[model samples]
Each structure stands twice: as C-alpha cells, then as structure tokens.
Target: MRRGENLRSEDYMLIDPFINGVAEFHDRHRDMRLDVDNMSYEELLALEERMGNVSTGLSEETIMKSMQQRKYFSIAEESPSSLEPCCICREEYVTGDDIGTLDCGHDFHTNCIKQWLTQKNLCPICKMTGLGT
Candidate 1:
C-alpha cells in the first residue's frame, strides 16, 4: 500500500461469521479436531495450518502494548526538517501534532496509526508485521 493507495474490498480481512462460530465451537471443545476423514496426513496438516491463521487474530491487549512500544512524540519536541502528511488521513502534519512511528520507520498521526493498527497488525507503509516482537 502507498501513501494514498486505494485498497480493494478484498484487501481488507473481513471476518467470516461462519468461521467465527466454528472457531468458537472449537474453543469450547478443545479436544475435538476438524473431521477431515480419509485424507492424507499432509492434506490434514495443510488444512489445520490454514484454519489456525483464519481463527487467530491479534488481541486488543496485544495491539495496545505494541502501539506503546512504537515511538510517539510531538513534532515540536522532536523537530524534523520535513514530514509527510498522514497517509491514513491525508492531512499535512504540523508542529504540536502527536506522531507515532513504527519499527519500519514510517510515521503518521498517533491516532491515525492507532486506528489502523486496531484492524491490521502491520505497518501501513512497509506492510511489516511483528511490531510487538
């Protein structure tokens, strides 16, 4: 994604309601595995791996802690020669604006980046994950 790139509907990870219900049922019955009968071991493993990705997303607490680890400061306190407008909001940054920077070295308005991270766990600029790590 670019500074002003438009994302398609498919670009956003829309949670599937049926998947959520299945995941919840699985959580309630931890010992039960998906009934993938008569399949090869490798096919079963592949399905299990893909299900893991679909079922798990970063928790809110995890997201908050990761945001805390990011660098945040006022533009006046840590003055820079130049700054880009926040890609999420597309407004030029001014002094006294609260900015947050990621480990990927991209900066945006603190609120803007926080909102972005709440839905996705990667840098809006570089598409890098593991911000908490």
Candidate 2:
C-alpha cells in the first residue's frame, strides 16, 4: 500500500518492517556483536519477533530480548554519569525521556530539538549544528 509495500501477502508485509527494523537495529549495534550466530533458528526468530514488538510498543516487555540475545553487547543505556541538564530546557533527562545527541557529543531532550528542527535543524544552545546538518 505504501511506496515500499506490496499487497501480495501478510508475510511480505511483516518481512519489510522486520528487515527495516533489523537494519536500524544493526546500525544501532554495528560496533557490538551478539550471540546471534550461536542462537538456534527458533531462538533467533523469537528474538526478532520481540524486537519488532519493542520498536513499535506493541508489547509491554520492559527489557528487550536482544539484551540476552547478544554477546559483548554495547547498547546505549541512559547515561547516569552524565547528569548534566539539557542545554535547551535546562531540565534533566528522566528515565523515559527521549534524547538526541550531537556529533560533538552534546545531548538534548527530544522534544526541544524536535520543535527546533521544525523551525530549523540546529542546536538551540551552541548553534554548532542541527538536525538537517
């Protein structure tokens, strides 16, 4: 129905999002390696299903299955050590806050930058760069 979608079958529909989400997940984990290669095909399938659910908030699993699916994992957990408040709102990033980080390693809450990106894509505080950059 969409640009990259087909109405041929249900499995095809699932495949597209699965592959796309896996691609995103791979980009998000390029530097990390999981025990994926070691997992049985059934286990891998289960993990992929869980990943799909996690990405879209369809399921209520607090932690993702991939956490246990990988080895030598390097996921980006919320940084507790960097307690610095967002440069825009001057508010701390809470447990469920969405965040975006700059190439310069500066971080900001998602809402602030999203509003700013709508106007233009640059950091509100430093002005070094923005979403478009």
* C-alpha lDDT of all candidate models, in order: 0.66, 0.54
> Which candidate has the top score in lDDT?
1
* C-alpha lDDT of candidate 1 relative to the true structure: 0.66
Off by over 4 Å in 1: 1-60, 68-82
Cα lDDT tens digits, model 1, 1-133, are 5667776644433434354344333465756766678879999889878778542235656655665433434456554546567889988776567777676777787777777776777887788872664
> Deviation in angstroms for 24 in model 2?
67
Per-candidate TM equals 0.44, 0.34
How do the residues 1-133 of candidate 2 rate in per-residue lDDT, one tens digit apiece? 5777656756565658665455334376666756887899999999888778422121112212111211122237746565778777887666667665544455666556555555544556677544322
Worst 10-residue stretch by lDDT in candidate 2?
62-71
Q: Clashes in model 1: which pairs?
A: none
